[model samples]
Target: MKRFIITEDGSHSLFSAQFNQQYHSLQGALNESEHIYINLGLRPALENGPVSVFEMGFGTGLNAFLAWKLADQLQKQVFYTSVEAYPVSMLEASQLNYEEATGEKGFMQLHHAPWGKETGISPFFYLRKEITTLQDFTPDRFFDVIFYDAFDPQAQPELWTEEIFTKIAAQTKPGGVLVTYSSKGIVKRALAAAGFAVERHKGPGRKAHILKAIKL
Candidate 1:
């Protein structure tokens, strides 16, 4: 079972008993999503007009919420597809404080959207939550951005391998970007091996660096 814990920034994240890892940063879940996923991934993708985004982990629905909120605020269209092997239960979802912080409605609807079919949650946001893992997922279309928000390499190294990223690159368009909070050397090597022109970016809070790998 997953348990919710309040982080340093007064936001709640799940502590996964199975993985023995937190779904997000204990420093601040909200800010972490905003910084790494939104500011880096979504915003840049929006520059190229309407965007199709693929996310690795749908964890707390926080990333989707932020994307939906930003798409609405920017008056841009977004088609978001997120893959997760395991989903958070309604009880765990209820304990999250993200909606309050974001001041955005429809978070519940995003979570409630039926898997395997694309659902229009808002005028600007269309979501398709896939109940699968990266290894098993096949893309329906190439994405403008990929939010590679999987667990740390220490916990789930298989997901961060070159083979997996090569699969990811196959579904990414030329110049499409993949962003993640990890700056580990092996991670960058894997990304490069998979055909991305990787760049390091300033990380949020105490994190030293984050990575943005572009398919060039």
Candidate 2:
């Protein structure tokens, strides 16, 4: 079962009984997404013209929404692809306070967008949400940015393996960036083994650091 919980930044995140984890940090969901994925990942990639992004998890659609908003603001095109094995239901998604917190609309529209095909969220942003696990997904094209937002190694160990990182690395373009809210030794080693130059950056809220790897 999944239930909504308010984070420190006044945004809503989901707690999944099956995973035994919250979708985002208890410190703040919106703050984390904006700082890690948007500021660190998407913004940098957008400088090189139209960007293609692949996300490992589409938990609350927060990252996607923020990316969409940024793309619109910059008037740059973004092709975002996200994969999720278990998607949040519309009812659960409706309970999120992201729209109110960010003062932006279209949170529901993002969730309501059909799965398995590309849909235009705005003139500058297009999204294709795949309903599958990272292990089962076959990438059709390379991406300029990757949001590796899978649950922690403790909760979902299989997704944090070297094999999974290698699979993702194969789909990332040279110089592409991959960002995640983890700085574990295993994660850094996996990224290095997958041909990435990994770096650790200061994290938001109570966390110490986050990982940002570049495809070599």
Candidate 3:
């Protein structure tokens, strides 16, 4: 069963018994997403113009929500694609407090949006949520930014292998960026083996460093 827990920043995060992990950092779900994925990943990609983002996990919909909000704020168009094998139920999604915390409406709309089809969340943001695992996913288009938000190596080692990273890298445009809240040596090695120039950056709360890799 999955349950909600409040992080240090007072944001709601889901605790997954199946994965034996929480969707976001226990320190702060909102803070972690904004810092690693938004600040380090999405923001830089948008500077190049209209951006296409690919996310590995769409657990709480927090990242997508923030991306949509930022795209609207910047008046930049974003085509967001995310793949999730297991999706959060609407009941579980409704319990999340992102809308309340961010003072942003549309949290529910994101959850309510149909899967496997492009849904326009706003004039600036279009989302397509795929119901599949990373192993089975084939990219239809290359992406500018990839949010590698999978479970930790301890939980989902297969997803962290070089084979997986290579598959993801194959669909990333040259110079495109991929960000994650993990700096594990295996991850760095796998990304490097997959042809990305990896860099370590200061992480949000508790974590010492996170990784940002650019497709070569």
Cα error, residue 152 of model 1, in Å, equals: 0.6
The parts of candidate 3 lying over 4 Å away from their true place are none
User: Per-residue lDDT for 125-204 in model 2, tens only?
Assistant: 99999999889999999999999999999888898888999999999999999999989999999899989999999998
Model 2, stretches more than 4 Å misplaced?
none
For all candidates, what are the clash counts?
Answer: 0, 0, 0
Model 3 agreement with the true structure over 1-216: per-residue lDDT tens digits: 588899999999999899999999999999999999999999988888999999999999999999999999999999999999999999999999999889999898889999999999999999999999999988899999999999999999999999999999999999999999999999999999999999999999888999999999
lDDT of each: 0.92, 0.93, 0.95
Indicate the TM-score of model 3.
0.99
When sorted by lDDT, best at the front, the candidate numbers are: 3, 2, 1
Please state the error at residue 64 of candidate 3 in Å: 0.3
TM-scores of the models, in the order given = 0.98, 0.98, 0.99
In candidate 1, what are the lDDT values of residues 139-198, reduced to their tens digit? Answer: 989998999999999999999999999999999999999999999999999999999999
Q: Candidate 1 vs candidate 2: which has greater lDDT?
A: 2
